[model samples]
Each structure stands twice: as C-alpha cells, then as structure tokens.
Target: MTTSADPREAARTRLSAHREAVLALSHSLHAEPELAFEEHKSAKKIADLMEGAGFAVARGVCDLPTAFTATHGSGDLVIGITAEYDALPGIGHACGHNVNGAAAVAAALALAPVADDLGITVKLLGTPAEEYGGGKVYMLERGAFDDVTAAMMVHAAPVDGLGFTSHAISSWQVAYTGVTAHAAAMPHKGVNAADAMMIAQVAIGAYRQQMIPGGIVHGVVTCGGEAPNVIPGRVTADYDCRAETAEDLAALKARIRACFEAGALATGAELELADVGRDYADLRQDAEFGEAYRRSAEALGRSFDLVPSGMRGGSTDMGNISHVMPTIHPSIGYDCGETIMHNPEFTAYGTTPGADKAVLDGGLAMAWTAIELATAEATRTRLLTAHAERGGRAAGAAAAR
Candidate 1:
C-alpha cells in the first residue's frame, strides 16, 4: 500500500477516466444478449477489452468455453472481481448483468494502473452462465479460484442493498414416460404422462403447506402434450428448489422427490429426475468486507435504508464462492420506475443513464474497497492467512488422494 492521502480517491479518478469505455461495454452487452454456457460473443467482447487494457488474458478457462480470466500485476494479495454477462432466455439483460459485467471491467481497469504500487494482483474473472449453469460453482470445483484471496461483485436491482443473503438452490429436469393411445378409441388402454405431471404439480402445491420455512419450489412444464386427441406419451418439466442452507435444501429436495414419486406410483408413469446444475450454497457474507463496501458506497452518496422485512432475495452462484473465501455481493440501484427484475420493463432501464451511473459507482466502490483491504494490515494479514490455509488444505487433499 502506498502512503497516500486516499487510495479511494485515486481509484475514483481512474474509474472516471475509463467511464466511457465501461459504459460502452455495458451497452454493447445489452444490445446483444446470450444465454448461459453459450455466451461466446459476450465473452469475446469482454476478453478483448481486458486484453486491450494490457492484462494477461486466458480464454476458455476451466474447460468452459465462455469462461476467461485476465490478470494484471504480480502480488501476494490477489483480489478477484467476477464479471457475469450471460442473459436470461428471453428477458435479455433484465437482471442487469450488462451493468454487472461492465462494473467489474471498470474496477479492473481502474486498479490496473495502481495494482503494482498497492502490492495487489487484480483478477477479472469472466464467469458465464450464472443464470442457469452455475459457472462459478463449476469454476470453483475446477480450481479457477485456487489462488484468489478474496472475491466480490455488484448486482443491479431496483434499489441499493447490502448485507442481504440469498437461498441455497438445486434445479432439476424432470420427465415422465408412459404409453400413448387414441383418446376416443382406447383411452383406457394407455397411461397418461401429462396426467402424471398434473398430479405431481398438485402434490407439490399441497406439500407447500407442510414445507419448511424459507423453502421454495417452482417449475415449468416445458412439454406437456402434443395433441388433445392422443394420450401423451411423455411429459417434461424444469424445477428449482431453494432453502436457507445446503442441509435444508437437501431435505427440501427429498420431500419434493417424494411427491414426484407418488405421482408416478399413482399414474403408472416412469419418472426420472436429472439434476440440471450444481447445488448453490447459501451466501456467507464476510463482516469486514461488507462493512468496507458499505463505507465505500456511502462515500459515493448511496444510502442504506433498511430492507423491508420479508423481502426475500433470489439465489445466486456467487453464494458458493462466498463460502470458500471472503466475498461481498452488493446491489447497486438504478431507476426503473416500479419495474422488478426479469421483466421486459426492467430490461429497458438496464442501459439508461441511471444504470450507467450504477456501473461507474459500483466499479469505483468495489475498487476502493479493494484499496482499503490491501492497505489495512489486519485485514490483509487475515486474507493472506486464509489463502495459505486454503492452499494447504488443497495440497493435503491431493496428496491423500
């Protein structure tokens, strides 16, 4: 850390210099949306920017074609800032990943000039498929985060929020198979897979009354039937289960599976469940990191009003990363005039002036937080010690194996 009046002020100035580039990146991503695990163009655009910024770039990271890592400076304290650019299937940037990715880029660019002086390495991770594929979870397993001391990213929402946690989740692809027959001629001769799905949905609805507090189960029937005159031979659906913790998520999944099994038993349909993606863990926010971020954001004129009671947060793969290291996932506000996330109206606001401001503010705040962490002896020591411990554990596990 340099002996300067304020590293944060320096970070803000650097971010201001890169303001146009960052906002341009955000708008470009918004114009072209890509889905999970399939973000080739989005990944390329971001990687290109990182390369242009003089970072050592590595594409196709962790066996994920859409994943990449860009590094600047060589220092003991490595700070990772994740950039998520994947869009929803139809809503396209409704969740403001364009803003998220741009903010990460802004932070990385701002820190690049001062990284060496601060004795910190900046790692900008292009994490894809956060919406459906749990890219971070996959990267975590594949050791993309092995050398990262701490990680953070900002999310875009209707209003600014901090210290809010999300549910752990598991998603599945479900199917039921049965014989098909003509409805009018031999309806009694065939088992109805569609009816099986209906039964399962009803059972799930009824089970909700007995479900544990904070548990959620929701799904969509992608394929129910082809024609009304013929008995449906197969039915397929996608479902998501969420709970307050990993253990609770497992228990909730068991109960939901039972309901599906009961539907199969009663309808004489063959049932199958394929796990769609990795199980996301509940977020564990680091107190020091959260406080540092709160101060940084507050300095930028962002207010922290108490979130309304019972206002729940959605699940995120970032939660998995938080469990392994010190991390913060805060929300930056943008005016959308009563529009909530995942809505088309929300998408409209993603590239607006307010959203652009969010990009700069979030990026600068995160970079400022990084500056604080790097300069503070106690926090730096704690993070460095944790990184060493993680390395030791990995080495021990590998040697035992």
Candidate 2:
C-alpha cells in the first residue's frame, strides 16, 4: 500500500505499464473507421477499455448514442479528458481521430491511479462525431460537461501547436424544387432546379467580396440532376457559413440564406434549408493549461509553434466545451512527411510508428498537465471557483436527480 514519492512519476509509470494496450487502441480505431454519429464500435471499444481500467462507464450519456462517459476517483476538482472517435467521410481517419481518441484514453488511464492522491477526479468522455455532427455541442447542451472543472484533448496534426482559435460555424442542407419536364420536348414547361442552384452559387461567389473579414461561405451541390435530357425537379446542396464569432456567423448565415432565396425566387423554385447538426462557437483555450501541456510535450521532444491569436483553424465541437469550462485543445505532432490533415495520405499514417509515438507522448503530456493543474493551488482554486460560479456541481446534482 505504498505510493510513489512523486505523483507525476507515478502517472508516467502507470502510462508505461499500459503502453501496449494504448497503442493497440489507436491501431484498432484506425483499422475500423466510423463516421460522425455512426461510431458504435468505436464508442464500445473505448468504453470497454475504460471499464476494464476500473472506471464507472456510462453509455449514451447525452442522448447521443455514440457518446459515453467514464469516471474514476471522487476528488472535488474534476478534469474532463475528451476522446473523439469519428472519422472523415470517405478518406477515413484522415483527421487522425484514432490518435486523438487513443491519446485521451491513455491520459485518463495514466491519471486514474493517482487521481485520488492528487485531489482530482478524472472523467473520460467518449465524444463522437467531431468530423461532421457536433457531438460535443449536443453533449454540452445536455449538461454532459457541466460538472468538469476543466477539459483537455490533444488533436493529431503534422506539427505540434499549443492551441489555435477556431471559427464559429453554421451549416445547412439546402434544396430547390421545380417542375420537371423533358429538356427538348417541353423546355418552356420546366423550371430548372439546377439553374436555381447555379444562380445561388454565383450569388454566393459574388457576395464573397463583400463578406466581413474572417467570414467564409462555401458549399457543394450534392445533387444537380440525374440526366441532361430531363430538367431536374430537385437540387440539393450542403452549405457552411463561418466567422470569427457567433454574432458574425449569424450575420454571415443571414446573407448566405438570402442568396439561396434569391435563386429560388429568380427560378420560381421552392427552397428548403435543413439545419445540419449544431452550431460551433469559436475556441478559447485556457492559457495556463496550454502552457503546462506545451512544457510537458516539449519535455518529450515535441516542439510547438505557438500560433498567433485571432488566427483560426477549422471549427470543432470542442469549441463549445471551451465556452462552458476551462479547456485546452492542443495539436500533437507526428511525422507525416508533408501530409496535411483530412487527406488520404494522412489517414494512412495515423497508426504508423510516428503516430504511435504521438499517442504515447500526447497522453503522457496531458497526464502531467493534469497533475500540475491539481497540484498548483492558485490554478486549482481559480478553476474550482470558475466551475462553481458556472454551477458545475449544481448541474451535476440536478442531472443525477
């Protein structure tokens, strides 16, 4: 019943003991890539692993079938470790969520043994559908993260970064309906849906010049028509609008919707805009936690290029978590040899030796950072005070009731 003299050393030792299983989890996730809310197998594997490690595992915590939570220890300062398991559509694991998920699991396992000693609670969240569907957003709205004092997750990338800003985004699935007629036989009788889509695209492109700084509007036509001989009765497109903040994003979406409406009016076609998942807010990283992660990562030979403020990366549901509590989403680097994220080549390297090393390093660094957060009195008090003010404990109690 003897504990190690240093908790950080003890955590690292525990992580080393579970190294093989951690690497296996990463490889297994890479081999079986699941997309968005369809991460059943991925969620089960992670939950099973956490359960085996003596955590109280809960599945479908926030009404999201693929989402889960695993808890260890009963300390007042709760730390959330997020594991994102969803992959990109066709490319699979292109964003390296396998590495991301495995690293988070590793961090939680590493900290679990020393959690009580450090006066902290470790909560591993099986957060799904980061690629398209905003699983974290849904979970946050449902109070999944309300109890946590702070949260952290490492994302896989070509280079290490302390953290970077992310855009606020809103996406929609738009469709235009019109009369169908044979192209040559009844040209006048047909109101072309394809023409309406084309006009919308043109209007959007023209509007881009007047768009606010850092605001972006982009989309793809999923369905234009079936045959050139027949006028398309329906055309569907997926659109995304993003800006620096929620207010800017709201304005941007309004302008983009106007373009869609104009297309429908000009072609006498009916327009429909279906909401696509939840809106994502801009990321706000906790500076102290970010520095701790950077120090721990650098100790393990990872160099981070601290991105300038206001420079935005892509949107993430994790951004929603940041708004609720102190959060850090740093990028863990691997040697992908010029392969950027979301590419087929990058997906191929997700479970390579470099990626395996990333899983270990990222996990170990996060564990060390969590230990620092617990041990530092000022930092711990600040996080706890903020958590209380936000009604973190009250929300947890309400949810339990």
Clashes of each: 0, 0
TM-score of 1: 0.97
Q: Can you list the residue pairs that collide in candidate 1?
A: none
lDDT of candidate 2 over 1-401, digit per residue (tens): 12357887888999999999999999999999999999999999999999999999999888989999999999999999999999988899999999999999999999988999888899999998887879998988888887889999999988888768899999899999999999999978999999999999999999989999999888888999999999999999988999998889999988999999999999999999998889999999988888888888888888865455446799998998898799999989888987799889999899889999999999999999998898888899999999888895566767999
lDDT of 1 by residue, 310-330 (tens): 245899999999989999998
Candidate 2 clashes: the total is 0
Weakest lDDT window of 10 consecutive positions for candidate 2 = 303-312
Alpha carbon deviation, residue 163, candidate 2 (Å): 2.9
lDDT comparing candidate 1 with the true structure = 0.92
**Model 2 segments more than 4 A misplaced:** 1-4, 306-310, 392-401
Q: RMSD in angstroms, all models?
A: 1.5, 2.7
